[model samples]
Target: MESPDPSSSAPVLLNIGGKKYATTAETLTQREPGSMLAAMFSGRHTLPRHPTTGAVFVDRDGKHFRHILNWLRDGDIPVLSESEYQQLLREAEYYQLLGLADYITEKLSWKKGDGTLETELTRKDVIKCIQAQKTRFRGVNLSGLDLSKLDLSEVDFSYACIEKTNFSSANLHKAKFKLVEAACSSFEHANLHECELTGANLKEAVLDRANVQSANLQDACLTGCSFIETDLRSAHLQSANLMGADLNGANLEGANLKGAKLTGTNLQGANLQRAYLREVDLRETDLTGAKLGGANLLGTIR
Candidate 1:
């Protein structure tokens, strides 16, 4: 007959950190071709074995080794806490298990209360929730979703990720969007009266013709955003970043723009009558034909 294959040989006893384990050489080498276990049991290099028991000795903590063996055998892992996952990740990395490390990282991102999606939900799930009247979506991830033309008035979306989402023509009156990441989002023609959007990131967003009157946008990032003809009357924009933003023909009458950055901003033909511009810098802003009658220019630059 043919000589015995080294990889398919008899069970190999291992002494890992004072713990004993019995497994075949093929079990360790067949799964991960480039792993530490494969290199050690490839029969190319000699390994240190206990003289008394003749078992291979490995200098590593065996607390999570069983889990590693189970994963190598059949890719099965149990639910673990954040700390436990972190610890197991270290072990996986040490063993050069790239796939297991990635799995652990994904699981870590799925954990709750971490400013990410606690559970990944599809658009159907969101629509179902809305139909069920469950409007509270705090800390949820709605990124790249199309939620336009929905009557989401008085909904709560605080601390949520809404980047690249389309909220155009949605009825969002008196809604809460505090501390949301809405970069490059669209709210064109949406009804957002009296909405709470303090500390929000609306960078490069489009709000053309949207009814955002009396909405709070304090400390928000509105860089390079398009607000053409948008209704922002009496809205709060204190300390907001409006650099390179297009607010052409927008209504800003009686709005608070205190300490707001308007560098390279387009306010052409926009209404600013009776608006607060205290400590605002309008040096590089385009105000040609803009209405600024009775507006406050106290400590303003330009």
Candidate 2:
């Protein structure tokens, strides 16, 4: 079906770049919210005479200009400029337009490169990633996708199925991974500083030499996940599950791990000074010479 004819003779209309067309002007607008309205914000689009309340958006018919949100939610957006798409993602997020920003951002995320990497994408895609609310991508079924060396920072991928996905050398600073269910995913040399992973399942995931400073892993499941030389200084691991996880030389200084389950989890040379350890389940878990100076162990189950 044809979209509501904005050019139809209606009570409200729009005049973009001197091209007058019928449209529903939106109410309650915030200037400089997204890239689509960059021209309007940069003093480019001339403001039309007020239709009601003397506002630049309101019209006599009282039709609102909320097409961006509608189009994003619908996911059938026509070919849009890169700047416009990036702006839409930002605006959609600020206005709580779910799936709108993510849908658009995914399109701008990957580039078709020649067989050997060096896959270069347009600059607009870069901006879309920057606009995402989180760094690491959350709960997205990225199976059989090649997204290597992409700059994906601060993404929240809780409860996602990311099996056999390649995330090599990506920047995922401060991403939230609470309750995620990713298996056999590769995160080699990724930056994951201050990440949150409560009650997650990362079985057979490779996280070798990833920077995860001061992260939170409360009640999480990381069976068969590798964390070689990962930094977890001063992190919170209260009531977390880490069965059969390899965390060799991971820094856990002064971490809070009270009532945590670490069955068959490796913690070789991990600093645990002043850590809270009440009722912590460490059955067959590797804790060879871990620092326990001034550690709180009250109400702990021996």
Each model's C-alpha lDDT? 0.85, 0.59
**Alpha-carbon lDDT of model 1:** 0.85
lDDT of 1 by residue, 1-302 (tens): 12123468587888878889988788887778788887777777777777787788787888888888887775546667788889999988998887677656655654554544533577777777776564877757788888899888888887677889999999999989976778999999999999999878899999999999999999888999999999999999999999999999999999999999999999999999999999998889999999989999999998
Report how far off residue 190 is in candidate 2 (Å).
1.6
Best by lDDT: 1
The TM-score of predicted model 1 comes to 0.62
TM-score of each: 0.62, 0.53
Best by the TM-score measure:
1
Residue 247, model 2, lDDT: 81
